[model samples]
Target: MIADDLSSKIRGGELSPGVALPPQKELSARYGVTLATLRQALQQLEDDGLLSQQPGRGTFVAEPRAAYRLDSLRGFAEDLRAQGHLVTTQILGQTVAQPPAWAAAHFGDADPAVRLERLRLLAGHPAVHQVSWIHGLELAETDLSGVSLYAALAEHGIAVHRAGEALRPGVLDQASATLLRQPLGTPAFHSERVTYGLDDRVLVADRATILGSMMEIRTEREVSGLSMQWVQLG
Candidate 1:
């Protein structure tokens, strides 16, 4: 947990870039944990590519952030293909419950949440992890397992009006790395997007962190019709 907190602070920009953390001894004292525990935490962070240890230079944080252009919206699947990558999804599990706080907000304060976990693949390589939540009643009659999620909703008369998104860089722990098939030190993209129906009615929300190896995105200013860009993840 200490290691995770440290990673979060550094990733969240609380520690800032080029910031040098205290020596192991000082960190141990400050956190009130033993040297062994401190080292363990630090090791975990290093494994997640959040930090680099310098034999005589202590440890330095890593720097990596996706440069998103201001002009376009890239759908996850289409974006992967635009990059000449193939995107695939492995639906891991699904459950129904009250939507989590974040999902609740996106789904118009849904009383029931449909949670789905999927592993995203880019060109045959496991990339981002996807966790989608939808309003239960809205999707209750839908048969998932295949087909685009956005399409499924539309078929049910849910008109997708727009989507809202948030993004941040975060360290990859063992579990996340394992899921992405990368070493623990890899960087992951934490992202959240909420889709709204017509009249801005909440339809569904998806949250995920794409692995670095998967994609790149930028928006373009077009004078006329729609213009799109993407590179498939798998």
Candidate 2:
């Protein structure tokens, strides 16, 4: 009950971000709870991402997480740039290969797809690790350094018309955690997408792992309720 009350206040904007909570003893007295119970309540909020506790320092409300918009065919780099952030891309690996199970499920016997792995940074901070499998083009002769897969495909006269995405909670492995600068088993967001080009041809099958602390899924629904847009924060 105490945790829920405090969480409601935080979400309702009564306790602004960066604002420190009351001292444990005082807070416990005000809430009519024991110190132990109050501490447990605060710990619950901390685990829920609403509070931050520092050693020797008091707890404070956490800042709002970044979000990503999914209403368009925008690339990871493009989305961050729109938020006035400097974006950089590092191509980890790129080659032609057989599609993985997830990719093959969408590509449907489209062997020899161009596979590319990338680590994208926002303002020098590691943000997302992504891998993509592109079909309907020969990317072996094309250069992808410093360019997004969407842009490279566009150069080959393939225009993305529509895309579908799925997102779920995940945990980072040792390899992914090292690249994203997070501890092993850290909470993460796992996203999969399939992009379509002209005539409904599949252009790209991609998967991405995003740092949960640095990103979230946002959706806006207009008052008229006719349209809704989904965005992700990185």
Candidate 3:
């Protein structure tokens, strides 16, 4: 009951982020509980990521975790920006090259693709490493620098209508680790996506490595007679 009450206050904005909790003795007195019981309640809230306790500074409401929508067709940069987070992209490399076997099969071509390597930063920290493969034959001389990849595609009348996506566990390679400022072999989420145009034509293939610590993926669903996917949260 104590934890629930405090959690409700935090969520209701009665206790704002970074606001310290009352002293242990005073809180126990207010709740008419022993100090041990009050401590237990506080510990439970801390475990749920709602509160942070400093060794000597006391407990305070924690900032909410950053969330990424897994059920959207939007770009990562677009999504993050909508949530009021500062987003930036650094183009690492851009060239025409043969894609991996899986990407080649998805594009239904043996020809090369325009490969781009980019690092996405959230609030000045590296959050994801993206590698995109666009059809080379269709865009032989297209310049991609200083523009959103989706915007560039839109210029050529190739808007992404729908996409197929999958996520798997990955280990950070040396190059990726160096760029992301993480140790090699760190666990990450590998996302693979195939974007389609209006006519159901494959437009681009994308692979992204997202840092585990920087963001979380969430999906919502409606539980009726049959389960159905619900709208995504920004």
Top model number, TM-score: 3
Candidate 3 ranges beyond 4 A from true positions? 1-65, 137-146, 223-234
- Write down the worst ten-residue block by lDDT for model 1: 64-73
Better of 2 and 3 by lDDT: 2
Q: Name model 1 segments beyond 4 Å from true.
A: 1-75, 82-84, 108-110, 141-143, 222-234
State which candidate, 1 or 3, has the greater TM-score.
Answer: 3
The best candidate in terms of lDDT: 2
TM-score of 2: 0.69
Better of 1 and 2 by TM-score: 2
* Shift of residue 207 alpha carbon in model 3, Å: 0.9
Clashes of each: 26, 9, 0
Question: Where does candidate 3 clash, by residue pair?
Answer: none
